[model samples]
Target chain A: MFDIAAVAVTIAIMITMYRAIKGPTIYDRVLAGNAIGTKTVILLVLIGFVHDRPHFLDLAVVYPLINFIATIAFLKYREMGRLD
Target chain B: MIDVMLLLIIVVCAIFALFMKDLLSATIILGIYSFIMATIFTRLNAVDVAFTEASVGAGITSVLMIAALSRTKRYEYHYTKLQRRKPSALFLKVISLLLVIITGAVLVYGTIDMPEFGDPEAPANKHVSPRYIAESEHETSEKNIVTAVLAGYRGYDTLGETTVIFTAGICVILLLRRRINT
Candidate 1:
């Protein structure tokens, strides 16, 4: 069932969280964190369908834009040592 | 039939995403998982959600991960057992796990009270939702009710969400900039 799929994604997210914590490199952690964000977007959409509320998709759409920009900004700062 | 296939794909992708040793591979698998989920959403008649997932989950998130990966090393050290653990760290992990479980339980209980899927007379369908679904195509000239709700009735919320993302990006830039400078 779709419910089971959601649960599976949750478990995967938890595993990704573990990697984020235990990762030896910052990039690994960043990758794991990105994965978590991606999963969250999907989860939001899935929950919307289960509830029959399309409005939740709005949040899903916006979440990635935020997450992506944040990651890029962080990477740019990390590389160049300056935001400006 | 398609539902079952989508569900199976979701499960497989989740498992692969979790257990994959390569961080890049895991991230890519996670993107596929999100894409599969979006397909499932479309199949459920939640077209807007599907669109959002496709845009945000599969598109932007993957790009961000790849960008971050380019800035640093790709693989993480893997060990069979815990090496060194601070007492405080252990305590924090335990507390977080407990909190997660409690929240999960509450959500499950809430789900039990929800109307069965696709019930016509469900309050969601009967209330403002029906009006939106009925009138959105004409009022907004958008055939998708989800698009109308997001861009029309709740336009302000979408703007606020965009602002939140902008703030988060600014904060990340500030934090990492300082680290690199020092």
Candidate 2:
């Protein structure tokens, strides 16, 4: 069950990778990167369960926090042309 | 299955990032690359390495790259706005390609003799891990082996990492501080 889900998430990651690589605009790339990051977090949890190691959740907990902050920072830089 | 796929995606991201004309897009792709790498580390049962890679690769490095990008031209001047096939540019590209191929070949060659992934009898594992796993809980009282290994067994390494981060923060502050005399 978890193997199937992990495969599905891996496919999703590959699909998202296309948008990130073939971006028509900077926003598209950023959005795709954010999506990839989210999927990676999910993959981590699924992996933890598949491997029967619950501690992987700690790493999953880290992704969204960093991903969201970095995405916001990128957008802020794009709009304001400065991080300050 | 997922492991090989993740590694493939990382390779794709690396190649695309190299060829990207937009610098910001490249930075974002590199973040994704790092994110995938952390997942691979987790898959390899190196959760501690995954944690460090996650924080440093996807977090601090992305933020730093974005900050740096904000202060510079956002496109590759040579490739995006100018003739990319200039003779000198072509020469540089060929030279860099050669360098990359040679470096990659050497790295792969070096890894040919590495013990298979997660081999229990690998020299380092045989030498160090058993002692840590057996004695760490008694010595350090950390039930988590990774915590014991990182904080108890390799305390100086952790201290050095903290010092490196502290020095980086201090340097960033020094570089960005508003001068009173200005």
Candidate 3:
């Protein structure tokens, strides 16, 4: 069931949170944040199915589209020290 | 049950964000917090609010925060003086802690009279939501009551939000504009 899947994802989020918090480098933190974002996208879809409201799937679509840009920007900034 | 899990994660993220020595990592943690918060909003059935939180929190704010971080030192040092607990700093910390505790206590006390969650007879439930849900389709011809309420009935509020964003854009351009020759 979706509830079991959601619980699995929630546990994964907690594990990823540990990585994000205990980061030994900014890159590690960024990767952890990106992983969390990806999980969030999946969780959003799972939540939609669980709630029987597919409209929230639209959010699942939009979240990844933007979060990737953020991770890329983070990497680009770290690499170049400038956004442009 | 899941809300409890998410809320606990949010608390951990906040504490880590506060104590993080690296500013960039703190910003990323904050992004995670915001992203999870959006998930919670979606679970609570506020799709539009969740959309805003995801885009603004995980995307724009993270990018902007990193950009801002470029001009600052990454680490906040707890130097010898701080480690030794300077009297003024100790006093300030105590004051802030007391203020936070008092504020939280006041808020909790204030909620004592609030109706239980999901109570149909709650004041918020007894309010205009009934009318909005029942009449929005007929009044605005919008099938989604949220859209109708935002775009039709509360048009001015949305306009104000637009105006605020526009002003922020203009301010950024004005502050950052530069001449090529210069």
RMSD of each: 9.6, 3.4, 3.1
**iRMS of each prediction in angstroms?**
10.1, 3.6, 4.0
Ten residues in sequence with the least summed lDDT for candidate 2 chain A: A75-84
Between which residue pairs do clashes occur in model 1? none
* Candidate 2 root-mean-square deviation in Å: 3.4
Candidate 1 runs further than 4 Å off? A1-84, B80-99, B130-152, B157-182
Docking class of 1: incorrect
In candidate 3, which residue pairs clash?
A: none
lDDT, residue B119, candidate 3: 90
Query: TM-score of chain A, model 2?
Result: 0.92
Better of 2 and 3 by TM-score: 3
Over the stretch B1-182, how does candidate 2's per-residue lDDT look in tens digits? 88788889988999999898888888899899988998899888888788778767877777788778877888886644356757888899899999989999999999999999778889989988889888989999989988888788789999999897677556444433344554
What lDDT tens digits, residue by residue, belong to model 2 across residues A15-48? 9999999879888999998999999999999999
Q: What CAPRI grade goes to candidate 2?
A: medium
Please give, for residues B1-182, the per-residue lDDT of candidate 3 as tens digits: 78999999999999999988788888899999999999999888777788778777877777777667777766777669656588887888899999999999999999999999789999878888898988999999999888898889999999997786577445433433343544
Ranking according to DockQ, highest score first = 2, 3, 1
Residues B36-81, model 1: lDDT tens digits: 6775776677765676676567655665665666666567666443
